[model samples]
Target: MNTLTSSAHLVNVDIELEAAVLGVVLQTPGKAADLLRYIQKPTIFYHSLHQHIYEAIADLYAQGNDCDLMAVRQWLKSHGHDTTNLFNIISQNIFFDLAPKCLILFELAVKRYLGQYGERITRMASDPTTDALQLLERVDGDIDNIMGSIQSMKRPSVNDHLKVFLNGLDGKAKNNGPFTGLSTGIRTLDEQTNGLKPGCLYILAAGTGVGKTAIAGHIVKHQILEVGNAVGFCTLEMKGSEILSRFVAAETGYSNYELDRGKGIDPYKINDAVTRLSDKPLYIWDKPIELIQLEYQASEWKRRYGIKLLVIDYLQLVKHSMVKNRYERVSEISLTFKEMAQELDIAVLALAQLNRDHDKREGWKKRPKLSDLRESGQIEQDSDGVMMLFRPHKFGLNYADSSIIITPQTLEIHIPKWRNGMPTDEDYPLLAYYDAPTNRVGSVPFPDVPF
Candidate 1:
């Protein structure tokens, strides 16, 4: 069997493999549409002819037209794509193994992507004027694109989506009480937000010294750690060791300060906490990351460890090169984080900072508005829900005044914008204990639960 292999001069693309997939699709158009749709992108093919051929067949099938040789040939001619190359894949030499053929082409496309990007990186590196840090950023973005293309190309069809919906609708997904999403284990917060649902993006925005990270740690320790659902906690603000120390503090009821300094806390309590947390599926990445790189890594976490949730320490820290203006950059970041949640079928909880505009509102009234989402209004627009944290006690409000009716120890979780269910009370926020020394946030004194 003579395979139509590409000449050595061309990029290392499998011409025969591309032809094989095309031949199989041309011969078998009955199951062709889904097959082509699974391929998703025509750019996977090495040859321009194969790319157009796939598109023509896909278009024919999509329009409820029969994709016979005559139909495909005519479509190609009408679209101004070459028809002479059609003869290459018209032969009966190829097997009708559609999936395997497509898989090979997918792999080849990734290799070609790497090679192309590698050459570009080398060229950029040779240019002496290029800023070293900027060059590194561009190179990382290019690599991320290659990885992202693989996940993007695996896009599911309508029927594929129908199965997931029907599976849950028919009760095959099982009945687990009132909520169906990943339960944050805070009964009130979970009940309100429906447990940080999949395909939804939640923003935890607050002023500095607020209990945003504490509550996030509590949720992870109490729920995710308990259920053992893998969570990818991307910390842009803090180091892995710092986050881990806080988690330990939350667990052992020791201050993160003492835990880090190794002074007041007992070594055995830290050991016990570490041992218990050892089995939990929590992955922490503590470094600055660009948007594409972050998305690529999250996808890898979803693939490798089956991460059900992604917690970004602070939204503004994730770098973006596409836009020069801060507002546009934040807008892009927020939108991509939202898309990533839907794409990976996971919940994204991004910690963000509220603008200082809230500070002028007087004592015990420093509550953040949706409009106060730091750099862009797009964060509020893109989010499924926005949770803002406000600790009046942090402002040195020693006692609960009659008007405010809150103490310094009390942590107020504000739900100014909730898309799922409206339990938002701007005037009076949800009540929780900060437990500062322990670095824990919850109703507190839970004998059974983790936090």
Candidate 2:
């Protein structure tokens, strides 16, 4: 059997004795070379005791608690340390007499753990049958390590290094230039925003029946079909098929009512709609208020379909696993959406309902201010962009037909907050397009929506 040299050294008495000496010094009043090496190869005996200390230290580090030895010792005591015999050992050895012996014990413990770890690694590597599981474990471990490294750099002193890293990331962002996979359904919005960059949480807010769902469907369809990207739509209020059927109508140039009736519109239009959208890769989940399930489905979607854009039909309908307070829950939901955007590297467009007060406002038919987002202002605070759908026609304005009464749909893409770019100076109504077929919709109509 081929054995590692370090493994032999680890099990040997010489190395054990050396580790014991170091352990004693590490626990002593004086600090020697940071004394953290023993933490790498801890034995079962020391692992128990040292694990407590290490965890306390880690907690302190995370909480920005004082790193003094007394604080660590006190933390250990509070966490049932006072009851353990190991606690006695640690408590008694704060002085110099047992320091050297403690060091020796620490070293022996470390070498034993390393030897076991080495054996485990070898066994995992050599066993061909266990390769898949081993590979996954290794990947998870690597991710944990990378996460640790990232966390370690979050110090004030490392701000310069972090700045450099951030600068590099910014450079990449600039080169990538937002619109890589963005879908505004309008060429102009895509041009301005650069395709709704990934890791961004975009909030669409508007009064009731402002065609929020319609606009979102239009975006999802265009993104999946035209941009050739996989997309996921989570509709809470509407049925999944209902949303998809709308897409069908938009893509087919058939109205939902007409499609349902199967009259008025030509049968060929139905076939055309199916043909246009059926092949495009778009996944949707309209489950009842399951945010966790939404995340789980998104993971599955990414794994199976590589979806690039994810749209939550509206925010209010998104329910969590356990929400004690509705207000607090909304905040959590907002944060979760932000996290989802960053983790999935998918642009998230979450539709939100405007507050009732906004509906009572004088000019709500044109633009919705940031304050109009219902349940949580945090939505506005957390979102990368806030867009409003305002139909002047909904109230009693005729943008399309001059003589007759016409309610033309209007969409205002408000740049209330652009974390990385310049926000628009004033809100302006962008021309909206509603495709009765294929359920597709967009604005600034360079490519006209098929009526």
Candidate 3:
């Protein structure tokens, strides 16, 4: 009966609300499976009796038994839960508004957990041996553990998604041009990848100073302003201000040089860029973050801003809470990115670094291969698409071998691995315009596809 005064604010758990939700579940056995997915555990119920009731219902449903009144009652009796309490639940006339009530129950359960967590922290703080800074970090982690449980994902049959897939296809044909998923504003990329779609993890890999962050900046701007979708960008390599400056440069067609030195810069254009971006739905985290912390913040970003996409600056930089084996850590990071993309129902665009192995290769093999992905094993396995950027210009090498003249500003995007669609021919990678001064990565209709 403890009251929680936290942001989620649960005054107390109501026994009646528990009974009401159970009533709804018992009346429809098929829906009980779904309810279990959403609520997760039966511990959401306040009283022990109510918890037992939910457990019995779930147990019966799992065994292919109908969760009707008589069946549930018999199971409860067999399991030793009082049948008299079942009548109290069955008598509840509330059938509608089950979702909201379940949410409330879930909130109460969260508060209960927080209360316990706070007590543990209190006991630790009481001891002088507990480091204050460590304790503070523990609090942050504890909160993430509690709040992260709010989102529950269920595995649905492929048939369940058939209508959605068809509708999406129809919408793309009628609404957007060849982009069934979230568009990148780069028509070539969108046309190729079908836009950064849900349930997909896209890895944009390149060597150092190869314009990964610059391209990512362009993408988020496109997603937020042009596509009218919110985006979250977390950078482990750069500062928040640096990302913003890149955004401003992309916005105003000013180079990073002009923006930084303020030489021959038009203040009004910068002002205009700021004005346009001020209200746009974009979240940025500049500093390095652990995998858990990034997930925590990403979850909050999704809840508050409804971000359709989350861009992690570079994969290798994502840390584990403690230092672990580099390969194992990166592997874990890669798989987590994929899971986060699926669980949050958002597109994950993770920028990654290519390994030195590519540099050791001769000829066109010098361009990154799927194997060149740093910790390539899991990254290649987990990503729905892997795009490797090769800038021969960056390495003082030119595409003199190709029919088209390669300038220093040219960008070669080699999509070596893809699941949603096959990549373009190996020799003919997607060409893009890299305006270093403006900090923008622009793409045109790529004509170099194998017939």
Candidate 4:
């Protein structure tokens, strides 16, 4: 159309254009055809003239200016737009499409433009309601489209993939329950915790050198070797190969120290560990700084390789990009990890460093309390269960003295909080062995320890 005809037609078209724009701005449907035509030309006025109009409106909004049509015309002229045509156009062209949405958007742009009576008009339109079930069905349809696109774009979240995962887990749990669970492998520990649940956050907390890492490694080996569950072992402090070597040493009954020292153990034990790992569904990631990278990696394993359980060697070393304060940072990491567990639908077992307060106390009893977790109290709060690894000998007690300490090589699997079950004494004092050389854990009973 010619410029003159378009300008003259502006009066006839203004209402529809305004209504269509307002509808789009308000995220309303049923006016798509109108908007499609209007936005066909994003720049009808010269880009410079359009630029001036936008800036003037923005300035009025910012300064809380209550400029009338004449003032707005003057402001436009001052800003160098050809005001002669624009002034005549804007002043006489009826604002035909000024719907409830347009009015509200305009009021937000220039509050002073909405006079005293405009408040009542806004409230009336704003309070308009719709059918609840219809709205829900519409929303559900929209969400289905969105989630479908998401699943297509990347991997399905574990929760989304859970039924398939659970089918696998159910079959394994049924078949392996005979070989592994409350009565088998390690009896005392299993009674309290049961075997680790998928999509769970298990925090194994303890002071340094208290067999936490060893115990975690042991759990991984047991689950991988005995139960046949796929494992993802992530360690921040130790190299993946180092952690694997420990697991291998533990599995093959070779002293890790002998291997490290190039001493007496048969090389066949190391070969056995390697051969076993190659065949098992166990993946290890030693690099621990990137949380998103870790999630991305875990997602790959879950999607491509069927990784069932995720084990992070410890929590404090797990980093985040957003947080500044160490304590608050840890809280965010803790929540993310918990969500990761739920999202992946795989059990996440994280090791955490307990506070030194446990060590400073008298009488050499060093059972870690929930409050003693370092960095964040949220660790205790977010965890499905808190398991503490307590070693009396680590506190300088005689590894042989069962009478004074009760259990030397035992882990106090204290379920300070169990969301799903209760903690009984039979479940506590889960037997643990700290193989110093290979750092392998065993289901060694506390009372059965040589100490």
Candidate 5:
């Protein structure tokens, strides 16, 4: 019997544990399927013979057949493998008493994997040509893989998950709580999404000059100023000063042009805006950052300020050095955002650019769809909610209500995909007014049809 050691040590095979698990499975064929819940992959077994035996059992189980010793032997024989020696060893070493320790087997497997990954990373670091940032990302990915393996061993069953969900519902009802997530300040958007739930990746997509940044700023400001939630905003497109100016314009109702040009701006109002927002827990990283760097920054913000929400201003601008191809890089970034949201237990709202093909389309065909997300469809698939900003007036469509056509054009926020709730179809699009000068967006009453 081999004792499991710390993960820092070199990995060794645990033949005793492997034999015990396989013996129990052979004794009770039904137990093979149950064993899979703890350790699914055959590679988790340290011994080659044990790996073969596990694979045979898994195949039989998947085929809806019993996996007793005879069946396993027959299957191995049919595959031209001599299991006589393997069966003898199993019979001699069988210890059904240790069947409950299968979890320990899974733990050892994870530890072994991590130890191997550490060696690989050390080798990579020794190479002078290896990019430091790329190496860091690779190491982070390996660690995530190791952690995922450990988590899988203890993952709850469907019934167990249902119980926890029902308990949450009961608690919500008892406490008379309605919103389970942070509010976006748009009433209809909040109602439709039940606010932005933690562990969700939301995509806010729009074409150029469609006020995506304005909408994201509005949401972050509402979170930090009104709801008193900490937020981290990462802007790859704009500088920190520019973002701050927008925030000030949005918060104080000052014209962005006036602020930018330093003309006709009241000094007192600017001072007041600065003083009011000085204490808000809003952190911004406006420099160009890769996905890994953003993850580190977001984690630090959460650790330092307990930030509850993270906003990435325009996903297309995020850089990744590991993958050279634009499409694959974007796909990796999108998946990374989703994983980061879930791992950090924070809501991530990422702004994305729509493809230029939408602009080439004719009337009504120009509206952005899920497929129009630039670079990769992974952005649309990975997002928990996809909100596409559309302004018909931008395309020279006149508003029937002439008053509404003035500054702050009517903006239609089309949600093509909402994983938790209903999506916007042809008939319904969330209506809002985008005041570009003030860097603000607010909900508007749905106008009559045929406009």
Candidate 6:
């Protein structure tokens, strides 16, 4: 296979469309500025000369100057770029109407970019030194980046977004139910947070042995079984079978310990649980995966199963090769998850580990806070909501408000940040009972004494 010939054959670019796009920008500067929103960077142009002219026009627009033919020509000349050919092409091709042509050009540019990426991947695959898995991972990351760029090129303006909002309002007004998003099945949490909204990221952070995974599983089960929503669970820490076992326990009220150790297991109950879960559209990827692989898998699941919710077992375990330092890598991963949520239009619930520094704090002060989010504070900044799990019994604090004795299994879900909704002081520390035997978490009734 001749790589060069193959690449050339695959590469597609329409010079006429490119010139028309440039001509429109050169003719109408204001329209050019608006079109720039669709194609922000000049590299989207396949032709080098076109790229240079677009760059000059964008610079002029940025400087609040006219981006007409003469201004762009003078700017290009001052920057030592040859503008004779571009000027000749623009003058020869007079495209007074170029709005639709701009979109066509942008689409062609994206196709060309993808074609070049495919060529690069093929070339890399032929290299003997490149590991196949590494090459595939890199290709996945590149493809995701390309798709993200294409999506951004078509991003809606503020007015377009307003129309969407008003449409949602119309739907909500007609529906009898209160939630516009998927419910977690916990009443107070649902009421306080209005369920989990699409295109938003939520973080559930807790210390070791605090049952963050259990809470996440509870929510996943609720979304799948109760709400009839397809969900994707990407567990980096556990195997697919292990997560299944937890779900089985949650569904059947079976003891996870008994199920895991294969001791005194009930065949009938297992069969019933399997039958119940068999029809649920719940997909799980339990293998260790980088952020890119996770995103690719999530996208595939969303397409195939229409997955509405995604859960990553723990954020700290997600791998990234783009950055070296752990903090920087986690920060990048955090931002990527947030962007992935918005891009996919799904609620992404990621579990995070609280920094161990909280363990060193004084009594009651040991509760996890937004700042205690391990590795990076960016997780808190990027998440639409942050829920920190704190078990008072873990810190040996058995009483609350000098009256009710906190049960050993009482879990406190502390919400320090809620971007879309406000939680009153009474709602700050939501109480839930964690039944470790069944590996399930549920809300406890208010003012109830566990003793």
- Per-model TM-score on C-alpha atoms: 0.66, 0.60, 0.66, 0.58, 0.63, 0.67
How well does candidate 5 match the true structure in TM-score terms?
Answer: 0.63
CA-lDDT, candidates in order? 0.76, 0.62, 0.77, 0.59, 0.77, 0.78
Compared with the true structure, the alpha-carbon lDDT of candidate 6 equals 0.78
* Candidate 1 to truth, TM: 0.66
TM-score, cand. 4: 0.58
Whole-structure CA lDDT of model 2: 0.62
| Residue-pair clash count for candidate 6 | 0
Top candidate (TM-score): 6
Cα lDDT tens digits, model 1, 1-451, are 3334454556658787677677776776554643553476788887878788878876775454667778899999999987876876867355754665666678788888778878988988899998999988887887786666565556578996898789867763577577777777666677677677889999988888787888787777765567778899998878888887888888888886687688766889889989887867888888777676677678768867889999998898898765789989999999999988997789999999888888988775666778777875788789988888777666766344565455665777788877857757777567666777778666533442344
Better of 4 and 5 by lDDT: 5
Q: Give the alpha carbon lDDT tens digit for every residue of 164-274 in model 5.
A: 689877876786445767888777777777778888999999988999998998898888888899999998888878888898887677788888789888889889888
For every candidate in turn, the CA RMSD to the true structure comes to 16.6, 12.5, 16.8, 17.1, 16.4, 15.2
Q: Candidate 2 on 220-336: residue-level lDDT in tens? A: 777777678888888888887798788777666667778788778777767776787776787767667555546656655765687888899788888654687877778888988
lDDT of 3 by residue, 1-451 (tens): 3221122343566776777788787776545644664565778877777788788876765444567888888887888777765666656666664556677888888888778878988999999999999999988987776666654532457885897688877877787356678887666777677778887899999988888887788788888888889999998888888888888887787778888898898888789989988988999888767676676677768767888999998888887744589999998888889988987789999999887887787766788788778778888899998888878775666565666767776888888877868697778888887777777667753333110
Give the winner by TM-score: 3 or 4.
3
Overall local distance difference test of candidate 5: 0.77
What is the lDDT, from 0 to 100, of the residue 409 in candidate 5? 63
Q: Compared with the true structure, what per-residue lDDT tens digits does model 6 show for residues 1-451?
A: 5221122443566666677667777776655544554566687777777888888876765444677888888988899998657655555355655545666677777787777778888888888998999888888898787676555556578997999799988987997887767888777677778888889999999988889888899898888877899999999888988888988987777788888787787889889888878878889887777665576567668766889999999898997755789999999999989988987789999999988899999888887877788864788789998888888887688555676568776888888888868643533487787877787667776333111
Off by over 4 Å in 3: 1-159, 169-173, 396-403, 445-451
lDDT of 4 by residue, 300-378 (tens): 5776677778888788887665577888888887887888787667888888998888777864456666788996478
Query: Which model is ahead, 1 or 4, in terms of lDDT?
Result: 1
Tell me how far candidate 6 lies from the true structure as C-alpha RMSD in angstroms. 15.2
Candidate 4, run of 10 with poorest lDDT: 32-41
Q: Which portions of model 2 show Cα errors greater than 4 Å?
A: 1-178, 364-366, 398-407, 435-440, 445-447
